[model samples]
Target chain A: MDLSLSTRNVSGPGGDRTVVEVGGEIDVYTAPKLREQLVELVNDGSYHLVVDMEGVDFLDSTGLGVLVGGLKRVRAHEGSLRLVCNQERILKIFRITRLTKVFPIHTTVDEAVAATD
Target chain B: MATVELRFSAQPEHVRTARLVAAAVARRAGVDEAVLDEVRLAVGEACSRAVGLHRSHGITAPVKVVLTEEEKNFSIEVGDGVTGTGGGAGNGGDAASGGSDGASSGDLYEGDAEGEDEMGLAVISGLVDDVEVTTGDDGGVIRMSWPTTPAVTMP
Candidate 1:
């Protein structure tokens, strides 16, 4: 299916960061898209990505891989990637995988962006 | 913009393939990064559920996935046999209570409180905004819809 993806730029205490708003279910099928976007952003010299998952309804291992992979890529370039997830289901995955400690997770995009700065 | 339909064998490997195709389609459609990840998660859960159901019943037909991108909704339809309805409640244990907490220890069917770690219909229902299950003369179909506008780059 055509999963809806929304993108915006947010500026705050964290300086300038790209906020990627995800609204839909994420799985192995769609993880590549996110990976590609992260790669492109890295190539363009844009780091500090904040993925807003408040609107996301679902996420799987492959989806988790994409996030972890992005974190690795961003860190390699001396950049950082954070997540803003509110859904219990999505958050549960992060908490279970102990990935919450890996990436800086915030309650909202504002908090994540602010923290990045 | 356009819809992509794919039919694949009822195997774990094909499920991965479906996710790959779905991701490619979403990227070509200009979907953002985080959003695309969710789509993949949902699709994987759905396909895995279908595989488990089919395996239980011994049906050897390719599972069909129709990925359609409408004006304001992105929808996925995954179907199996004429009556792929049962086994819905088995996974409901995970929903009623988030008990497991995410511990993938050995096989889930052993002695876990929240049944097994079978992430299928329950996972999809948890992730998607709207889930429609239809059973009739045709067959059983699961339709998942997400209400959000895609990030389309215009020329």
Candidate 2:
């Protein structure tokens, strides 16, 4: 089956920052692609990720676990992983898993990109 | 009563099809629009878990999803051909602790992520209000149900 999910890397407003814009359903089949993108970013030392989930229509437990794993990879290097997701359905999973507390969620890409620790 | 059965090889790619079919059947059965997303997510998690169990146990049987639209509710059952993998209310307890993501088991997310199998159930429990997980010597099934609006009848 064709993967309904797509991801693209865009240069963030600040240099060296990257935004992984993900669209379509993220489930057991497509989650590995997202995991690969995150791993590649950290491998290249490009942290401070804004996973713009504005386009994601579906996210399951496997997808959530991938995000959690990505967070661990970035934090190991003192980097941060913030999500830009305003969709209620997408946010609902984070709330259900109580991951809302673990990851900083923003409504817009700019809001997430501009926020400072 | 109406029924739809989907049987496919144990593969992650087919989980999407199962979720889509379940959501469509639920919508037709009058499931609330707002809760449709939850239904889809819950179905997807259940199907994925079944696939995982089938893959790990080397079960050649296809994963099974049965969608039933009853008078008062619409229900889904995702079945796996694996036995003795935490049956009944056994591992179901972790649905609560699943929220405690800060657990020290850092390696749980790597290499096929066996830990993720349980995490998948945690997610299913979280999304589904009325759900049940039962296993037997032959196989296991994750059943989830949602209330459906009564159909209107013209006088």
Candidate 3:
């Protein structure tokens, strides 16, 4: 079975940041695609990234790993990675992993793109 | 109790099937959307762990998933039928040591450093009401359950 998850690059709220909007279930099978996309973005010199997770229905550890890997990749280049997640379930995963304190999570792309630190 | 059992190859693609069936069962059991989401994620986590373990151990056995509904509770058990490689089961033992509630944060993300990757057991522990891991002669089994009724009071 194929999850309906897709990731595409879009302009952020401020029209400066790169935003990746992801939709559908992100499990072990689909996470690699997101990972590849994030790696490709980082390799292309796109540093500041905002992942919009409002359309994500489900997320497992594999998905979380991809996000963490992306963060590390961007951080190595002195860049920042932000996440836009408002769903209780999606936020719960971050909280469980104690990653809420590690990553900056915002409720909107506007706030995430505007965050300076 | 209505029970549904499935056995498939220990592959990543099969996790999606397990999650879909588990979600459908939870929805039909009158579980709300929030609880159904938990069920779907928890089942996916379990199946993913089983598949990863089997692959690491070079075991090509099928992973088994069982979904059972009784009263207002829904439970899922995901396991693999491969023979253990002795020390390969150590991780399962550490995970199972968290007991029935499975709320031990250490057991979930034991040695993961910041930005380090780990399994989804901790996420499963947070989403489900109860979690248990058992490693026996057959293989490792992760059992998780959730109540159909919402436990948290919504404002």
Candidate 4:
């Protein structure tokens, strides 16, 4: 079975930050893909990222770990990683884990990309 | 009262199906719609943890899931078939000393899988209001339950 997670870079090369659009369920089965993408972007010097999760239908602890790991990777380079998500269910997981304090979540991609460190 | 039993190979991909079925059953059991997402996520975490344990022990047995709808509650039991996995705590540290299957994949994971395993359990506990974890020689079982309204008869 194909893992339901999908990710795409929506931003062009010249922007100060890269916007990655992610959709589908983020779970143990597909979180590796997100982790790989994040690692590659950080390696490629795209430190600042805005992950647009508006299309995500579900997310679990493993997916949260990947996001937290990504945040750590970017922070190592003195950069930040923000998320654009408004889904109550999706946001609940962050609140449950108290990770809302770690990730800067916004309703719009523009808001995530515009926020200062 | 109603009961549904599902068994599948210890694989990550199968976790999604388990969650879907659990939520549908929970809804039919008169669980609140707003809390359906919690049910789905909790089931996913429990099933995923079972699959991980089976894989870590090199066990070929499938993971077992049981959904029970009572008069005022919905419960899910996610059980693993890994026997003698040692480490009653199910931590990565003691998995290597388990039994025959212990050495199968221990070297590859070292302790990373254990960390994820702990985190998965933590997430499960957070999502479930009434949850229980028990580990013994027979293996481990995570039994989680949520309150429901009056049972709705199925069509």
Candidate 5:
């Protein structure tokens, strides 16, 4: 039950953004870990955040809730939230939830990073 | 085709571990990842319901999970001993509320985010192709089934 989380610092469209990449499953059990990280980043005034989920194996509604909650938190601070997901299943989830419009989705981390600036 | 059976404590921590093991095994069996994940989620949700039921009834025991993988489909059965009681119905929420045991459904869904998390069961029901609950002499069983086919229906 180990989830691998990776982070990257990029300078892009907006200015400086932190890309937090998540791999493995994001279910009811492990989603809190991601939430904690997102909250910390937001607290540190990391306004623009991109979550790379291409390597994510699964995502439950709880996971989706965390994303929605994080997006709301960032937007409240006049920041933005985006996603990098190439997996068709994961992509379909965002599409099904109509979250594709709510968040900027990119095919690559590079693209997601680029869009942040 | 092979069958797998796993029994573990009903504690929340154990439930998560059991689910991860089930998903990993299913993936190794060549099941599609989405389907595997669907099964895992269903099994986990069902187990959560069972734990809630146990707390209501003042009974504590390990939940048993039985998984059967066929060429065309796979099925999982979650069982807890409480036969001839208010279980096996399609709706576990009702069973927990009946208060036949010491705890009431109200208690199960009472004031916490766990109740919100309980919604996972609804998601599970929607994901799996088939679901059944059987109450018999030994206990109550919740079984979920899915086709081997990939679950992502492109829209």
Candidate 6:
């Protein structure tokens, strides 16, 4: 399984937020790449992040851990981390881990970014 | 109903392969989408735990995965030959504390971090219908089962 990650800046009413779109499977093998990207973004001063997980086919606990770590990193900087996930399978993971309450999840990138405003 | 067994090196990358295979097996067993998702995640978690255990004990054995399909249920068992060095006994402590907060107490991001092996098990228990863990001198085994006819539907 390959995890493809791409980042783009989205300017919304909430200001410019980096949207990281992830595709494919996110297991233990592929989560490190995501962790690296997220850590790099936070270290580079980009705190407001929207993880678009609509394209993600599968996600495991390791992937969830990386997302939680990213959320903590952004929160420490007084910023917010939002998630865009519409797939039921993908969303089920957050719900199972009880992370649905921790991260603001939206159906669209616009909604996720606007929530941060 | 068919039974499939696979043995792969206890490597992180093989965990993904094992998950994919399990998903395929569940799909062939006529499992619904929701149940299939649960199976895939649960299998991945089991494989990840097995790989971590093997690495911890410096054992270079292969992890064994067995999938059994029944008329009304699908079961998966992931086994590893590496014996526990008293580490598996304390694996679930941090994971138990991290419940419902999403801030997993397990240091999953740290490559060399020890303990917290039960972090994935916590998530697996929520996804599947039933889960059982057995550990002894012959390493560890995690068996998870899901009903072919799922009771929960995606809303």
**Of the candidates shown, which would achieve the greatest DockQ relative to the real structure?**
2
Best by TM-score: 2
True contacts kept of each: 0.05, 0.46, 0.37, 0.29, 0.02, 0.44
Tens-digit lDDT track of model 2 for A37-104:
88988999877788888888788878888888888888888888889998888888877666787788
Worst 10 residues of 2 chain A by lDDT: A1-10
Candidate 6 regions with alpha-carbon error over 4 angstroms: B30-34, B70-72, B82-97, B102-116, B148-155
| A80 Cα displacement, candidate 2 (Å) | 0.9
* CAPRI class assigned to model 1: incorrect
> Which CAPRI quality tier does the interface of model 6 achieve?
acceptable
Residue A14 displacement (Å), model 1: 40
List runs of model 3 lying over 4 Å from the truth.
A1-16, B30-33, B82-118, B148-155
- Candidate 4 lDDT for residue A13: 42
What would the TM-scores of all predictions be? 0.50, 0.90, 0.79, 0.83, 0.65, 0.85
lDDT against the true structure, per candidate, is 0.65, 0.79, 0.72, 0.76, 0.68, 0.77
A8-115 per-residue lDDT for model 3 (tens digits):
445554445788888887888888888888899999988888888888877888887788778777777778888999999889878766667667899997788788
lDDT for B1 in candidate 1 is: 31
Give model 2 RMSD, 1 decimal: 2.6
Q: What value of lDDT does candidate 6 attain over all alpha carbons?
A: 0.77
Candidate 1, TM-score vs. the true structure? 0.50
Task: Give the number of the best model, judged by lDDT.
Answer: 2
lDDT of 4 by residue, B1-155 (tens): 33899999998989999998999999988889988998999899888888888998888989989999887788998888866543233342232222123222222222266655655666676677688877667678888889998755699
The sequence of per-residue lDDT tens digits that candidate 1 reaches over residues A1-117 is 334577777786756788888777665446567777878887887777888888776676556656766766667777778888877767866654445656678897777887844
Model 3 TM-score (2 dp): 0.79
User: lDDT tens string, model 1, B1-155?
Assistant: 33899888777657878877887776655556666766676677677666655666688987888888776767788877638354453354353234233223212322221232233444555555677766655556777766555665699
Model 5 residue B135 lDDT score: 82
Please write out the lDDT profile of model 6 over residues B1-155, one tens digit for every residue: 33999899878988988988999988887688767767877888889878877886787878999999887888898887765444332344345445454444323433333422555776776666577777778777888877786445579
Q: What C-alpha lDDT, on a 0 to 100 scale, does residue A93 get in candidate 6?
A: 72
Please tell me which model should have the higher lDDT, number 2 or number 6: 2
